[model samples]
Target: MALPITDHIVAAVSKMVDDSQVEGYREPSHSDIEFYVSRAGLTDADPKAQGQTVGKAKRVRAILSWAIDNDQTAGGKLVESLIAKVRASGGFRDSSANFIGADVIARAVEAFDSEGYILSSDGALRPKNLESLMGRELTVALRDYARRAQKGSEDAALLSGTSKDLLEATAAHVIRTKYGSYPQQANFPALLGQAFIALEMATPEDPPSSTESPYRVMERGMYQSAVGVNRLRNKEGSGHGRPWVASLGVVEAEAAIELAGVIAGYMLDKLDNR
Candidate 1:
């Protein structure tokens, strides 16, 4: 399914595209438009020949619309680029020549926030959808782990630990939702199995039969991956107080984080759908 693009984002981009009538508005040059179009990898027609305000707005809308329908990631990147440009320009001025940069920024920020992203101070975008899917507390912990893991001194152990926490939190959320509370003393695999059981979905223990559906096969694989994430955390993660550091690099750590995110998202999605 195609991911959503908010109306506010489209409006904000349209405003930036043709704000010449505004009192202190600085119109983007032809080169500027071309640059943006090129950066977004849009290849419909010449942006310059797209005509005046109305025509330009239509072109922008069409590009964004097509992007969302065809490739949602590209669509998201395009929106991110537009928002960054608007922020960089400090926004356009109103008819009274009042600086309304803050208002524009607020609208853009709010739009992204609703979509589960944090536009950081340095303009870097980070996903925070877990907050909405799981809860704010779990999301907060995940974000902290992400931030620490991505620091200049990247800690593989910490990243590994975060991956485990990601699944733990997800499983805990599922079990708690179904049974009022999860077993605190349960091990990682047990907790994860309980989550799948609570959701009435297949777990790692569910053996593949000749007549098993493809979905069950996929579910079994996913459960195994969750267990693997836990195993990695136990061996290389920070909580063990290991005497020697594991021979894991940033790339491995990043992969672990990404894997954890995908699994967690899948689990949470199942929870929501069920």
Candidate 2:
């Protein structure tokens, strides 16, 4: 069976196929004969069975010699050279979209829809189908790109390379600048845990970064909100309530966590505070 990679195919591909476009196919096309020998290669003809057709030309070099011997234009002859170029190899053989005698190849390319594979508002060949693919295969390419980018974000979120030791550190910076310290507690792990959650909750397009648990715009913005905030939350209440203060005791940063106090006022008893 004919495969995409073959010496003859390579030779034929070399003659007309734009070397830059074909990725990694190179062959010597010195004259008309070389061109013919190479052009004959584009078909699915078997090297052994088709040997009789281009007879005794065994290799691409031998085929070129034969073309020079019998044909004046070498073996470059084809029913429609341009259309043939598109069938055997994608891309335009010549500057013109028209192929010999018919526009079969060009028309087929133009037939595709924009998203499905249009002729391209600019006259570039778009891969309409996976019949032939060079370079990166587009079959699962877009999806793979998404996965790779997502994986990168997850890694960055895990890094914890920030100044603040709390979730949404970036937001904390802004909020701290305005409100002294963010309402977030100075706890390390709890804030970091929230940061991780923030990063995970982030859309694939944008992720949260920082030391604190990125719960909102802070999570969606920069800063998981704090360092180890996520770990602190997970260590205790699955990641729900007040920021855990990782210290000798609990000390609020610049501002007090009135919410924690509020909950304490409601669910948490005064004895529990002790």
lDDT by residue for model 2 over 78-142, one digit each (tens)? Answer: 21242244444334444433211124334433333322442322233233342233222421322
TM-score of each: 0.44, 0.20
Model 1 stretches astray by more than 4 angstroms: 1-164, 234-245
Report, for all candidates in order, the number of backbone clashes. 0, 43
Can you tell me which runs of candidate 2 are displaced by over 4 Å? Answer: 1-49, 52-108, 111-274
RMSD (CA, Å), each prediction: 13.2, 22.6
Question: For candidate 1, lDDT tens digit of each residue in 1-274?
Answer: 1235666566655654555445544534445655676776764533444554344456666667666566556666566665556545544333323233455545655766776655443333445443334454554444444443335223322323233366677788788777777798899889999988887778767776899788887888778887876666644434446412366555765666566666666676677677
**In model 1, what is the error at residue 123, expressed in angstroms?**
7.3
What lDDT does model 1 reach? 0.58
Candidate 1 has a TM-score of 0.44
